[model samples]
Target: MNLRKATLTDYGVPPDDIPALQSHFRHLDENDKYNLLQVSIKYAPGIETQIYDSIVNCIGYRTMERFRDMPVSENDFYGYKRKTMAEYYHLAKLTGRL
Candidate 1:
């Protein structure tokens, strides 16, 4: 299994830390989740692909349920076009994510 790591400079979060994000998201209120999604609606700059890879690495460290069952609602990132964040969100939504 390959491990990738990178800082989402825009959000100040390492994309490889999905587990922590999941745990924290679970404890947050609806508004807080929305705010977090809003804040994470973008990536740093030129590392979108690395961010995606890191997210995949992060997901590999956990069960599929953990990624799929994030506290985010279906409409959370509805219209956001953030590449890195989008990669993570869409991967979580994809059927049979590995």
Candidate 2:
């Protein structure tokens, strides 16, 4: 909520306008998602504890289904696994995980 300390405010978003920001974030690509995660952590530190954790848990479960349903090889599966883990790590860090 501290605009001066928040990276999001650099994008001209006010703290009171987070819902709209979140809606916009939902439509971004993977690279954009990762970038938003970083920006979100900088701007809305509490979101990791509040929203990011829940989203990571949900996406982690769904990634399994996606990987299985895909035609990728074991190596590719590992890549996806790593990416998922990285995403979780960022989320956890943002959320203040141990």
Candidate 3:
């Protein structure tokens, strides 16, 4: 398996670590997810492809049940739908839909 390392440049931020972004997102309130998504989409632009790949690399493939389940009822800030933001990114890559 190949591993992909992410940096602030990947997310259009000045910081040098993607793990810190992951940790922050993990603990952030659910409502903040959209705001975070918007910022990511705006600043990172094409970073979605890489973000999807990185999430899959980190979490492995999500179970079908977990993948399809909707954890967030809100329309995606990125206009994609899935169990969670990570799952959206993962599925997008898996299906070549991103």
Q: What is the lDDT of residue 27 in candidate 2?
A: 55
lDDT (10s digit) by residue, model 2, range 1-98: 32223243343445565454445434555655565456446533433322333243334324554543434443443333333334444453455431
State the lDDT of candidate 1 residue by residue for 1-98, as single tens digits: 11122233333345665555555434555554444344344542333333333343443212433544333222222112233443444443342221
Regions of model 3 farther than 4 Å from truth: 1-8, 37-98
* Backbone clashes in model 3, listed as residue pairs: none
Model 3 — which ten-residue stretch has the worst lDDT?
73-82
Candidate 1 Cα deviation (angstroms), residue 35:
1.1
Candidate 3: residue 8 lDDT (0-100):
31
**Is 2 or 3 the stronger prediction by lDDT?**
2
Ranking by TM-score: 2, 3, 1
**Candidate 1 regions off by >4 Å?**
1-4, 7-22, 44-98
Residue pair clashes in candidate 2: none
**Of the candidates numbered 1 and 3, which has the greater TM-score value?**
3
- C-alpha RMSD (angstroms) for model 1: 13.8
